[model samples]
Target: MVVGLTGGIGSGKTTVAKLFKNFDTVAVYIADIEAKKLMNSSNVIRTKLIKEFGKETYQDNQLNRPYLANVVFNDKEKLHVLNSIVHPEVRKHFQEFVQLHIKKAYIIYESAILFESNSQQQFNFVISVYVDLEERIKRILERDNSTKQEVLNRINNQWKEDKKLLLSNYVINNYSLQETSNSVENIHNILTQKACSIL
Candidate 1:
């Protein structure tokens, strides 16, 4: 089974994913991390990104993430184009990863754009992490060294919090670290049991 764990920028989904890693029965795939790697390592992605965004797309053969983010986050169409170039390769890689981890009770595919990119169907269960807007903004500002407007522009590109919660099979409220950790444990137990059941 694959569980799609997703949330908007700065919603602490990565923290929840790390908590899930404590369980022997669970394996986690972080899509954004892999996508970044692929963008740098895969020739196809590199070629397309350069074709679309020019030589500035890479510096010394590594993806210039900040330059790309600046271009796409402020332009919705450009962001879609960027995702189009990257997401499919990530999806293909994920399927191969799933085959390798077939024995695990379940896998968590944590993606920032799982819903926005129409990827929820690939998972048997989907979990949405929720943190208040201000908290999310603060977290992003602290960690990303980005301006409020830049962060807000990225946030605006995604589906709203309520929409994600409504579409998700499960929701993790991630305001407090202790409480969120407890929630991850509980959800992990539930998912493991479900994955193990004969029915």
Candidate 2:
């Protein structure tokens, strides 16, 4: 079974994913890890990014994220162009990962833009993690080392929890790590039971 976990910036989806890692499940973080690999490994992607954003977008053959961030984060069209380049590459990588993990009873792919990009349709289940907006902003400030305005700008780009919740098979409101673990376990239990029934 393929499950998806997603949330807007600073919603603790990664924390829930880490909890799932402790289980006998294979979990893939598409946005953070896979995106990094695709940017580094694919010369085509690297060239396109450089052409779109210029040579300063890379340093030592690596993505100069801060330079790119300043470009895309402020310009919606630039960010969309970057996503257009990166998302397809990441999706291909995800498909390959899922194929290789077919033996696993359950597998998870986490992406922040799962719903926004209409990617959740590929998963058997979608889990949306959320937190109070105020709390989420606070967490983003600390985590990303960004000012309030910067964090808010990023948050503004994402779909709100209310919308995501309507589509998600499961919704987790992240308040604390312990609570988040409990929520994941609840979903895990349900998934396990469903898998058993299918057998």
How large is the C-alpha RMSD of every model relative to the true structure?
1.0, 1.4
Where does model 1 exceed 4 Å of error?
Answer: none
lDDT score, candidate 2, position 186: 90
Candidate 1 residue lDDT tens string, 4-82: 9999999999999999988888889999999989998899999999999999989987899889988998888999999
- Highest lDDT scorer: 1
User: How far in Å is the alpha carbon of 175 misplaced in model 2?
Assistant: 0.5
TM-score winner among the candidates?
1
Residue pairs with backbone overlap in model 2 = none
Residues 74-157 of candidate 2: C-alpha lDDT, one tens digit per residue:
888888899999999888887788788777667888888888788888888999998889999888888777889888778887
For candidate 1, give the lDDT: 0.92
Q: CA lDDT, every prediction? A: 0.92, 0.84
Question: What are the models' TM-scores?
Answer: 0.97, 0.94
